[model samples]
Target chain A: MAEVKTVQECASMVADGASVMVGGFLGVGAPLQMIDQLVANGTKELTLISVVGSYPGGGFDIGKLTAGKQVKKFIGAHIGTDPALVSGYNTGEIDVEFNPMGTFIERIRAAGAGLGAVVTPVGIGTEVEENASKQSFYGKDYLVFPPLGADFAIIKAKKADHYGNLCYDGTSMNTNTTMATAGKVVIAEVDEIVEVGTLAPNEIGTPGIFVDYIVKGFSTDERKAIFGEIWQKGNKLK
Target chain B: MNSREIIARRIAQEFNDGEVVNLGFGMPTMAANYIPNGINVILQTENGGLRFGGAPKAGEQNPDLGNAGGEPITMLPGGSAFDLAFSFCIIRGGHVDATVLGALEVDQNGNIANWKIPGKFVPGMGGGMDLLVGAKKVVAALAHTDKAGNSKVLKSCTLPLSAAGVVKRIITDKAVFNVSSKGLELIEIAPGLTEADVKAATEADYQVATNVKTMTF
Candidate 1:
């Protein structure tokens, strides 16, 4: 049976040197409180997979962990904003794996979907193929990215019922749904916790079966403000 | 007219009867408003949808349905959604005919500098790299100068480039320039603007276009 707990309690479930997957794109829908709790716990040698750059100007999330040297490896799409991760890579303090944004997300989804690998032509001849397995099929080269399963997946949702049915609005649906399904243990931090069956079935982005734990009663206003600004301004391609 | 409206009107004139194009954030998004009548251009968004016609109205925004920039956008008739991977396949695979993007700086070599500065807190390089690499033709629209009046058209960019040798043309408030292998070629001047005036505002070496003409207003 899944347990209901606080963000700090959920953070306690993570051990040192664990491989973790976090859901968010540049701080949107990230489990900020849980991340802070994990930082406070001071676990060492963690590997973090994230879609976003991570944290408040590099003061939070995987950025803070990377800054503290707790994160030993980072698998992310971009690190343009995280000074700690960028500088750490330059100084050889951290192992960084940079994948294309779309490919990175698909790798996580493949893990969730129980797929062994996903073949793509995106990084076939590029640096993205470095350290990745490659094969020739149908006279064309394809890069086979292995699924990235995690010991723990920390996700954030707008609201959840006691049964653990989750719903996210808009771009918030980026990676949380896949993370919920890919982790050995899934901990969801939600703004509201209501009675079971109150939320309509069609509205559930992640069903109750995928979630192993729930952390209730955390305010997500700060995260919303951070994400809203990025959504409004940062997405402009130019 | 406001600067945005003027830029929008200018972009609308670039479209033909039937073209498939992608619009980047800022001034490029404004192009949706300027699409001319009788032109049936399909607008492809990087986040995973394609629509034609125009921007969405207020209170009708869908979170799941958005452009690459995460803005709530409306879909035209026959609009469709795909995964982000397939959406980018359309970009990097050269299926996209053209892309209009905004820029912070554009250099003589057609390099784009829009993602970040040295120490700013911006979310850098969302999808600009893929668009630059894959688009058939790239068009940049930006202010003629920075807030401090420094030339944004530079000899070389001081910031990291989004793409090298990808920009085909640039349209700024002061003038229009075509990016060539050698360098920038002055093509059209904004109405009532002089060659010396445009040259003084740019830090790049430029040659007069053989067919230089006044930009359509």
Candidate 2:
């Protein structure tokens, strides 16, 4: 029973201090229309949970929000691609909580699956071990990472049904599938929305039950235009 | 030959056939080009690609298929794409046979520090920590000294450590060292470089092997 809404209408549901999970690796998979709406709404003091920062160079994708100083804190694995974020962190304008890439997603997956914690050796004997609790199982030490859930998850997908079943294409599926379930209010932005029973069962990356709302985002042609715009802007530096 | 290329060529000799390997950014990425033609090694990009070919030409680039560094690459004959979860599972589940990475500092105890530098505002630890702790064999490729002529090989790391006591082999412009229970052991020195030059440049105490040879590749 997922509702279809405009990006502005869905973005209005977010409060000033809400914790948000933005799915994408840099810019490719970001829900740009929804993100633009959030920026236009002037949402402030948000806690952002993402896998990586915006694409290299600023003034596009999540870099727009970061440049606007809307995010108060960022929780992610890598933020190197965004200079604004680095400047924010250096100036104490933004607080950053860094996690190893695997542990970050695993924690989100743990929240989605209702699991207690993630125990693995990915961060053992390193700086990441400082915050984790150590336990010995199977004669090896593992750092236990806690689950990470958010107030909202803004995700991008290739297609979806009216029932909100999602299907992703190519690398865009990186973090969107897991973040869809880890948020209390999941908003999926897709290129096209079909009727119920349109998407086959095996093709769906995330089931409809996990999606609370669906918003029509940029079509493929529009996406290509936007990419061209951004790429051209980046090429000016070269 | 440039120092980076020489180091990359030297480390490329370590790859065994039928092994799954991951190369980190910077110097380690160069090893992909030097991998022997018939080695049959599979390259894994942490951004969710495996069995991928080397970097693609400018016009041949596919936007959807790129490495973790966002460089365009080609998919080999047996290449496959999985999500980030499956890619990391391959890393953390001990399926990656060897991982070559860059290092900022390495110590006699074989501890590595590469991800962060205090007051420098680094983006975040992307995959270095996980790769260091998870891979079956960890090989570090780096310059022997920092830009300021400071020794990068030290008695103990001064910067934040990425992982502790995990490095097994190190190939630098000056020489190659092996980490053992006894600490850093110099097994090979670069051509025209003597054991004394290595000792003078290195801050960490290391044992010179009884029969050290000049680097070949």
Candidate 3:
């Protein structure tokens, strides 16, 4: 039996200092409502892994958390978009490990698949080597990036069946599908929930077994408003 | 011609026949229009699909099948999707022949600093770092000056770099330059443009090639 709850309930499961994997690229496909609930809950000293930076800045969920100093460490591909994260990093308020985007995604996928480690040539002779281990195989150099799994994986999806099976629309499937199996507890927030077997088998992106809980909520329209603010700020720049 | 079209045509000339190429966002995206007729160059996009054609007609765009820049694109025959692992396997595995990218700045040591500025917030670095290391050759298409009319070709970047010493050549509206161990060597200048005119627009000291000629359209 799958238990459905609210975003607040999902946030309650996250304790202070928990390691979490968040799904999305920039603002797309992020579990905005759940992130908001976490921010409101005021859980501090967290380790966050995401592809994008904090949030869109001016009151976005990720940005607010970063600004509130809830996060202690961050591992991801880029932080250029989030002013709070960048400022925090530069000011030594937070620790950051920057992974290449593709490599970051692969590390999460490798964790989900229960792989110990994966080898790639992306970070060879680059700053990515600062944290990653390098090894040679068959006379070729490769960087060994460890698989990343979190205590909780929070993600957004388009729809879900009563069984907790998930479906994502279009490119929204980006990182959520892989993150489902990369965490000890997978919490999903969906816009719509249907009866069991309602979703076509072929449309199921993540099986119910990988998902631990489902949260029902509407993502706030804050992102569009934030974009407007950013655009306004950009227009004023010389 | 507009700056976009000029940079696009210049990048198209850099391609050899039957080469596999990846075009990063901005001016490099325009190269799809200028690929010579009968050339079988395959365009690999980091967003999962490969063999993308020219821009899609209005109402025919599928957001899921778009390029890295989120622009509507047409898929050529035999296009497919693989996970990020396999997509980069083609990249870091050295299957791509060349990659053309847009840059914010290029320094004397061939370093690119396109990912960020000190105070301004921009999207984080995408596949530029991976492509720079994976592709056999790197070509940058950009304007010679910043929007504030400052020179972007510099002795060294003040901003954080996306790739270190990987730029092979740069195709800009004012001139063409190749990065050598000895620093930036000017290979060509736009027709009717003088060496002094070009030098005043750039911050770096440039070595003029003896065989300078107008870039063929």
Which candidate number would show the highest DockQ if scored against the true structure?
2
Which lDDT tens digits does candidate 1 get at residues B1-217?
6656666667767766667788876788777776767888888866556673333443333333444543445667687655455666788789888888888889898888766565553344556666777788898888888888899999987776666778898888888888989899998887778898998889888999889988775
Score each candidate by Cα lDDT: 0.73, 0.85, 0.76
lDDT of each residue in B43-65, candidate 3, tens digit only: 88775557776554433434233
Which residue pairs show backbone clashes in model 1? A26-A52, A170-B63, A235-B69
Best by lDDT: 2
lDDT of 2 by residue, B5-122 (tens): 9899988888999999999988788777788889978889887778887655434444444567644457889788766777788888789999999988899998988888888748
Give candidate 3 misplaced runs (Cα > 4 Å).
A54-58, A219-238, B1-9, B12-22, B29-90, B93-97, B104-124, B142-161, B164-166, B178-187, B194-212
Q: Give the range where candidate 2 chain A is weakest over 10 consecutive residues by summed lDDT.
A: A229-238
lDDT per residue as tens, model 3, A1-238 = 4579888888999999999988755545668788888888998899998866743453564777787888999887777667888878888788887787778888898999988887877656455677788999999888898899999999877788878898875445657788888989999888778899789998888888889889985633343344334434434111
Q: Residue A143 of candidate 1: its Cα lDDT?
A: 76
Model 2: CAPRI class: acceptable
Query: By summed lDDT, which 10 consecutive residues of candidate 2 chain B come out lowest?
Result: B57-66
**What's each prediction's TM-score?**
0.67, 0.93, 0.76
Write down the worst ten-residue block by lDDT for model 3 chain B: B57-66
What TM-score does model 1 achieve against the real structure? 0.67
